[model samples]
Target: MNNLATPGMLTAVWISLIVYMGVILYFVVRGARLTTNMADYATGTFQFSPAAIGLSLAAGMTSAATFIINPGFIAYYGISAFLSMAVFLPIGAIISLIVFSKRFRKIGSAVNAKTIAQWVGIRYNSASFRLYMAFLSILHLTFIVLIAVGLTQVLSRALNVDALPALSGIVIFTFGYMMFGGANSLVYTNMIQALLKVVVAVVLLFSGYQLFTNADAGFFQQLQQIDPKLTAAFNTDSPLYRDFFEVVICQLIVGVAIVCQPHIITRSLLLKDDKGMNRFLWVAVILLILFFTVVFTGLYARVLFPDLMVAGKPLPLDAVMSAYVTTYFSPVVSLFLVVGLLASGVATLESLIQSISTTITTDIIAAFAPNVIGKQQLFVNRLVIAVMAAVTIAMSYQQLVNPDLSVGILAQNGVYASFSAAFVPLLFGMFLKNVPVQAAFSASVAAVVAHFGIYYGRLTPYMETGTRNPGIAAALAILISLLVGAVVLVLYRQTKKEVAV
Candidate 1:
């Protein structure tokens, strides 16, 4: 029953995969038709309803980690994981998006900024700054690897295929199509992915309701029986959730800063009108809250496999949910869940590829080679994507074969570091006008140093343990960058006042 080995089931999954790919290809082709230039490819030329764009935003933001991989952590840990990932993180990100979206969109539109690097570079009037930021954006390739690995784990298990082949297929197909679609196709595809995820999210969240039937030892009590720490708000046994500070405070700050990613912030630029933006935000927020709560399903996995073993072998943290789906659900439902998880990965993967490749081509390459025409720019964009795909395959295969406490760790390290550097520049650019570019530049440099320094130096007691959590380093970096930028801004203002006198 757990294996999902029937020929019928395998056939159904294959057919579903083919249909999904066909539909996606059709949209990509249509979107590519509308995309005549780099700007059109980056932000899309078509007019999209805010509701659709908002759903697209929600899909892009909630990647495989949200629906698939993070659940594995919750399955291994417990309520504390839920608190950090599901509750605090979402609250911070949503609040950040609400506060930052309008301002970011306004400035991005005024300057006609297509990528985050362009926004930062143009705002500071530094082409070198743009190149540096674009280089930093390459860090998002880690997220691309994370999604590839997640989808591979889910699909390979569901279809009983090898991880390498599944991973290769996923990377090639998704990235191959992504080279053509850009924002135009991405919006339509993401909207559909989001809709599918909404269905799967509802099913998974309600799946565990039966566990509550026992009065003397209900669901929470069952978790308490296995490991008393599982029911606790702070699981000291887990490195990531040592206490309230790491789980709540650290995660809150990380969540707030996480919205600074290029794929995430640039989502607002897709909306052509304010009415659409408002509707998009409302739909995205409500659905995202639902999608995030899917982490609670991890607790159900714990109940089924208390020891976290699928067979003779121990279940790796990343493999927990995929194993759970294979074992718990009927074959038909398993196939559906498999596609849902695939959607989760593709949604974010498309956005990352489009954003990062566009930044490299338009902001970095084109900035230096001003004579490069639009047709050549598009060619270079596709070429960059191909190079990125190759890099992703190499990194993803390494993590798949010999992971360091889950691919999520690798992802967090790169993602947190990039966004940590970006936060200061982005925040300063948005709210504070007339501030010295040196402050933004210096703040970015400090963030990179502080983040990597704290992480590698093992500066915090939380990171002294065998399992290192990148969230600590990222949270600290955000604070340090803010402080440095604030000091610089204040000093500059004082100098201006003195000169006036």
Candidate 2:
């Protein structure tokens, strides 16, 4: 599509973005000043209020997926995608957060674990397992690519620039600042981002108010006018929202396990103690619910562009919101909205970069490579973040140029696989005592195998279509992992009982 954004508007956006980056850099430099070593970088030494940590947690958990990518799915598939993403998935994740957070926090705090990999090593007493998880954490780079692509689509459209320059700017600015800020700067920036997201979410959700109030035809009727299935709870025409299996059940399972991600779960570790748990959770959950509803804006985008076309050309799904924003809003309001969108993308991007790099540096590099002292370790982490940026930029550029529908597919595959593997280890470690580490390890192995096997082998009905849903593979992996853990637990208990007798 020809540049829908005018030159004057593009210039305004560029100026505002430059100002935004400057403010962000100031914070990162300040945080870097306070950061003495790798430990401080991984987990902040700053005293954070429950509200700050909670908001940061929400921002980390809700990323480009909520604000950008998933909304595209909603626009394409209608209410079925909404139900799966904004409703059922939120419920499962919130429930998991509530149940898992307190227990996990107590253990994490007690051991003073810096990374999730370290938590696993400490919990199961296995250095090799920690190393394995550190390697698996590389999967999060797919998520980073999603954010990068999402941001690139938004900014390139807004600035009327090529995708490569926009992608480079996003990766370098976000990831470069991240190498300095770590958790200390991240929480501060994320709090601001979460607040911006709250405003953006409200604006986006209500942007369709005119359609809702139409006397001749309401929103549902309007959607029905376009496609009969669009108004339905399930849209069989869509690849990702075909049935209950794909829509409701699978999403719920994925939701519950999604909390096991390093950036998501490790947020609790930022808390000073257990006392902040309830307040932290309340703030995070309430804000997250609001953030999740932003996907409803996709429905509005469909109502605006029923044919998914702009300027007589078909709009890419990833660019739908960008088109919607530029088409609807005044240049000034569009600027703020663009900032919020950037916040949504970069907040989680910052967290993922920080967490993944820290994991690699502390858990993998330190464990294997020659003894690295405090200052050296800090330097190593910065180096790791730089390397991660290079890799992410390379992958992100490919997805930007050529994607399989949306980048969500690639992200969900890698991210879901990592968390699926982590679920058993996290569950058994937090809740159960004296459990054989082998059971958790076996379950982890089985979960990864099951997820990849089903996905690649097309073992299930969900994979029969041209575009496969990763949720199906993830759900099955989680279930199989649970079963494997249960079997091992029972056998271990039986042997102990026999020995006692």
Candidate 3:
């Protein structure tokens, strides 16, 4: 909570951030040269290597949550958070990515779909559904706000500035370049960010090496010395990691459906051909596993800040990582860590801006006013990004000032609702043949209702709690969607059979 960054560190961060902006601008200019139309902007005109695309996927999937936010949860609740976030969540997400990527890409390519909404509409032959999903895609703005807030937390601490100016600068700069870069520049930038994150992840993970060496006991024992609850398999004291259901079952379900988001699932479409699929998957999975483990740094932070305080001030859940980096590391090392932290947030933030803006421009706006977007689709897309920037600035400011535990909760509520709605449609469309559009549509609607209905309405005991878990609501929503979809599919088949008879 205190400004731990020295003047020297602030100078270093400013220089590094400026140089970083220049590098990003160079890529944006290059990518913009190739992007004459919205289509080129959406999917890129280049044939990227599987390794590059894989790194992009890894970077996009990790986001600020992996490097910056979720670790706060780990610091608070302990290993139970680690198992839920790093272990079980990745297992389910990787499996889902492997299963869905190829099939989704196949259909997406066949239909020439650029965005998730476009893919859904073309897959089911429904213009209205595309518009509906495009509107739903606006939920991703919550995620963008999450990344913005995370980046602001890091930059504000590193530069010794207030959060408002830091957030505004981040949104303007990132969204400005993203309007031009799209997929073309996003992959290259993400690949670089992923590599930087790998270095920082290693540095952060091993920063606590002294803790392991100084104590006679093992790591878990050290944690036990701090608090037995920190070493426990389940942290009953924590709201989110209270039990087996919340820690494991709910996370696994959410992980599987999490890939249904546009920036994540559409990464497969960036591949030029099917032959690259294996290499892409291999690179992404390996990097993701490494990136996920970065949450272990939270354990180290917990060791350092036993009471989660600095200078007699309590650390917010979101500020734990920032406090650790500034307080524990040397100025030069903290400089590197700060830049890497920025990269981790920027990587996925870029993807979200590109994918969401494209969806709004090509899917939603074009649906309503096709003639308005006739030849100046690129201009319209830029305008949409500008509007998104304003919205992000407004929403992120609110979260920075007053959050529900952390911005992660607000993000999960909106993002979980989105992908929960998307999961049924994508799953039924991918694996099931002759599935009625009505079934998928009905299931998507049910998912939206179920997720928000549970969260805000507090329909269940889990929701009734003060600190509600979005994963519980999301998992229930997914299950309800599956049930509703299956029932509808069966009824449709029965009606068809009766008609044939």
Candidate 4:
């Protein structure tokens, strides 16, 4: 809330942002020139290297949450939060990404699928089901809002501007360029952003080097001196990392299903062919592991701001990282860090805008009004981005003003529910043949119902808190979806056998 940016820092940030915007526009123009139709916009005609696409994947998958937001959880809860967020979650997610990418790419490329919704609908051989999945994709707006808010938090502090104007500028600029660029520009820009992020990640990770070396009691001991809970494996004081179930099991489930999102999974389609798959996976996994470790910087922030205050004002969870960067670093170093933070959020925002707008245009609108599927589709997609921009601005403003601990909570709720529904369908569709559309549809519906039901209805002890863990809700929903799908499949098979007999 406090203005922490020096005049020099503010001037540097504005200049950097302007230069960054110009670079982005160059790519957008280049990519737009190649983007003739919806297919080209979705997958791109230009053949990109595996390493570039890998960087893009790592960038999109990490997002503002990993860089800007999740660290606040670590700042609040400590090693427990880090283990769940940085360690266990990534373990599940990396393995899932590795396992799912090849199969998903093979199927998606075969079907010429542009979005996850289309993949689901095509895999299930149901138009109505595809429409349903497309509509469900709107849940990703929550994530867009999360990134927008996170970016606003960083930019507002860096530019020494108010939140509203910062939020507006971010939404308009990112969405505007995204309307033109699609996958072509997205991959290239994300590659650059990922590289910047790698530098920033290293800087942030080592920022607390003095604390670790200078402390007589050592780092963990210093944390223990501050609060014994900070050094604990499971911080019972924290809602999210209170138990083994919450810390490990639920995160594992959510991590595996996290790839079900459109932006994350459809990334594989950017690859020209199967030969690049190994390089892509290796690059993505290694970079992502590094990005994930940036959350440890939150622990550093905690060490610095033990009371979590800047100039006597309490630091909001969302503002913690921004505050730390501006307060601790020199003006020039802070400028670089600020740009990296912006890149982290903007990278994902672009991917989300491209994927979600494509889904709405290609899968949802095209299904409802087949006439909108042709040359007019690109125009329609831009309109969709405009509408999304407006919605994101509105929602981001609300979250910026009034957050439930952090915007990450709201994002996780919507994002988790969406992927929870998609998980069973995508997994079954990919691995299990002869899967009935009815089974998939029923499972998706059940997952949605169970997720929201448990979350809002407060059916579990975890949900009883004001700030509930979306992971727990999503984990439950996934299990319920699997059970319901398996049951329906069994019944359908038995019915077929009886009829044959």
lDDT per model vs. reference = 0.90, 0.89, 0.92, 0.91
TM-score of 4: 0.98
Candidate 4 runs further than 4 Å off? 1-4
| Residue 268 CA displacement from its true place in model 4, Å | 0.8
- Cα lDDT for residue 76, candidate 2: 86
Q: In model 1, where do residues sit more than 4 Å from their true spots?
A: none
Q: How accurate is candidate 4 locally (lDDT)?
A: 0.91
Task: Point out where model 2 deviates above 4 Å.
Answer: 2-4
For candidate 4, write residues 367-455 as lDDT tens digits: 77888765699999999999999999999999999999999999999999999999999998899999999999999999999999999
Which pairs of residues collide in candidate 2?
A: none
Q: Across residues 163-218, which tens digit of lDDT does each residue of candidate 2 receive?
A: 99989998888877887788889999998888889999888888889988999998
Residue 499's lDDT in candidate 3: 100
Worst 10 residues of 2 by lDDT: 1-10
Q: For residues 1-501, could you state the per-residue lDDT of candidate 3 as single tens digits?
A: 655467766777889999988988998898988988898899999889999999999999999988999899999999999999999999899999999999999999888898899999988899999999999999999999999999999999888889999999999999998988888899999999999999999999999998888757777777888889998889988889888999899999999999999999999999999999999999999999999999989999998898888889888999889889988998888888999999999999999999999999999889888886534999999999999999999999999999999999999999999999999999999999988899999999999999999998988877787878899999999999999999999999999999999
Q: Model 3: which residue pairs collide?
A: none
Index of the highest-lDDT prediction: 3
